[model samples]
Target: MRLVTFNILHGRSLRDGQVDTGRLAEAIRRLDPDILALQEVDRAQERSHHADLTDVAAAAMGAVDQRFVPALAGTPGAAWVPAADPDDPGTAGYGVSLLSRHPATAWRVLRLPRIPFRVPRTGPHRWPQRLAPEEPRVAVAGRFATPEGPLTAVSTHLSFVPGWGQLQLLALRRALAAVDGPVVLLGDLNLRGRQPERLTGYRPLGRRPTMPAGRPDHQIDHILLRGELGPVRLVDNPEMELSDHRPLVVELGARRG
Candidate 1:
């Protein structure tokens, strides 16, 4: 099976500062992933041409099943609110998504709580600067019926705040305790290096730096597995035009059905 995790930055190419769906689709096609997890996705938003970016990605990858869980009702870097529900049918929203070529048998959602206060922080050489309030984040899971048996795949984008990302990861781990079968977690954790592995005990299938796509120096995107699966046949971080991070792709054996 070939699985990929990518943070598309809302399909905006940093090169020209444009949201070109054509380029996004082409990149998805080239990866040709059997299962794809995407973060920082836009839907019915003016920034991304009012197109359902998750749907676009699903079609691009030829995924037979998909789930987009809206984390915020508004836009990021502007104005937005925590979505009332996971399946927020709002005209405009942003969140994470999971797509699979295999049939899905079940689905689950987990909302990661964030810091409640908004305070300004100062750097070593700069005065205190108040940043935008932290936004709500979510994780979407899908249990698929593959030849290997039922496997649970989760897609999520975690908090960037210090220590908070680890808290959320722990919460997610507690929530998955009730689920059965092997598990595959994929997304941008914002927790670099081996932090996630140290916290969750899940084996990272790949270890290539993926941030600042132009010149990646550290890894924030990852593909982690909690249970047994086939050996890692190939692992790659495919360079693409959209997003600030590269797409981390992993392939295990053939017949990725």
Candidate 2:
């Protein structure tokens, strides 16, 4: 089974600053991931032409099942509110999503704890700036009935602030512990290095840098596995200009009985 994690930057191309669902769909079709985890997904947002990005991606990839959990009620970098109505399609929001070709039997969304205190931003020269409010975060978990067995997959986008991201990671780990099958976690964690592995006890499946698609220097996006899912390897793709971050793809072999 193939798994892919990508931060689509709300389906906007960094090269042209355009949000074209057609282009985004074609990009996902080319990747052809069996399971896809996405961050920075927009739904009914004016910026992205009120497009349900997750739905578009799912249709494009021909996913059998999918789920989208909003972390916020409005667009990022703009005036936004908290997400309250899960059934309201007209409500604009930003969040993470999961798409799978395999049938999903169960699903859950875990809302992570946000920092109570405001975090101050730093200037380009590393000077302290005005305080900024912490955005709400969430994790979407899905239990898929794969040929190898049930696989629990999670998609999340954590805070970029130091210490706070770790707290979110810890919460995610605890929530995932409830699942009884092999777990595959995917997202643009924002935290660097081997911190995720150290925090969640999940081994990183891919090491290729994904951010700044033009010339990435950090492997912020990741696909991590908690239990053995056989010999997993990265799927190589030559072109990656759809979003700011390059998509990370991995193939999971049948589990050994």
Candidate 3:
């Protein structure tokens, strides 16, 4: 099947300094992915015209099933706020999303706690209180019933801080351990293309870099499969200059046992 992992940067297009839903829609149509994992998606941000990105994206791609998990919440018109409303995950400025053409059997949001530590006090920073709370992070996981069987798809955005992201990565690996079926992990891992030994249970598809879209010298965004699927192909949708990171497409077919 054709699966895609994209960091939309909240649907902001690099071609223009604006959040254009149409451009975002067009990109999905071109990719024609059966399953999609999106990062930096805005659920109710005023900057995005308060448009629900998951819904808009589903409609744009004619997807029937979709789920969104916000990492933190934001005010109606204020996308800058970093506060997360315990009452609602949708208000979060950032989130991860899963969209599929097939019906979803179940869905869940996996919240990953940050490592307890203080930011270096020597550098210029934002509000004083901002640095105290645990750096928020989350993963959106869902089970999609395909013709073959139930398949799990997970989407998440890891921390960028060194050592900190490693802890988050371990948390993600543990979360995946609970699933007992075929699975695919997709997201912006914030890992520079080096080696996979730091993490466990899966392997990356290819070695192409995806960050700084212009240069793309690192492969942070990734798609990992569980079973011994047949040969995997990595897709680079280079024409869609909608975000700082390039979108990745992975093709997987069943393998013989």
Q: Pick the candidate with the highest lDDT.
A: 1
User: How badly does each model clash, as a count of residue pairs?
Assistant: 0, 0, 4
Worst 10 residues of 3 by lDDT: 120-129
TM-scores for every predicted model: 0.93, 0.93, 0.85
Model 1 — TM-score against the truth? 0.93
Q: In model 2, which range of ten residues has the least summed lDDT?
A: 233-242
User: Whole-model Cα lDDT per candidate?
Assistant: 0.89, 0.86, 0.76
Writing each residue's lDDT as its tens digit, candidate 3 over 92-188 gives 4667889999899888778886756755322345334344444478888889988657889888888777776678778878878878877788888
Q: What tens-digit string does per-residue lDDT give for candidate 2 at 173-214?
A: 998887797999999888888999999999988787776788
Q: Using TM-score as the measure, which candidate wins?
A: 1
The residue ranges of model 1 lying beyond 4 angstroms of the native Cα positions read 119-129, 254-257
RMSD of each: 2.7, 2.1, 3.8
Tens-place lDDT digits, model 1, residues 96-160: 99999999999888999777877455565768666567788899999998877888999999988
Residue-level error in angstroms, candidate 3, position 99: 0.8
Off by over 4 Å in 2: 85-87, 120-130, 235-239
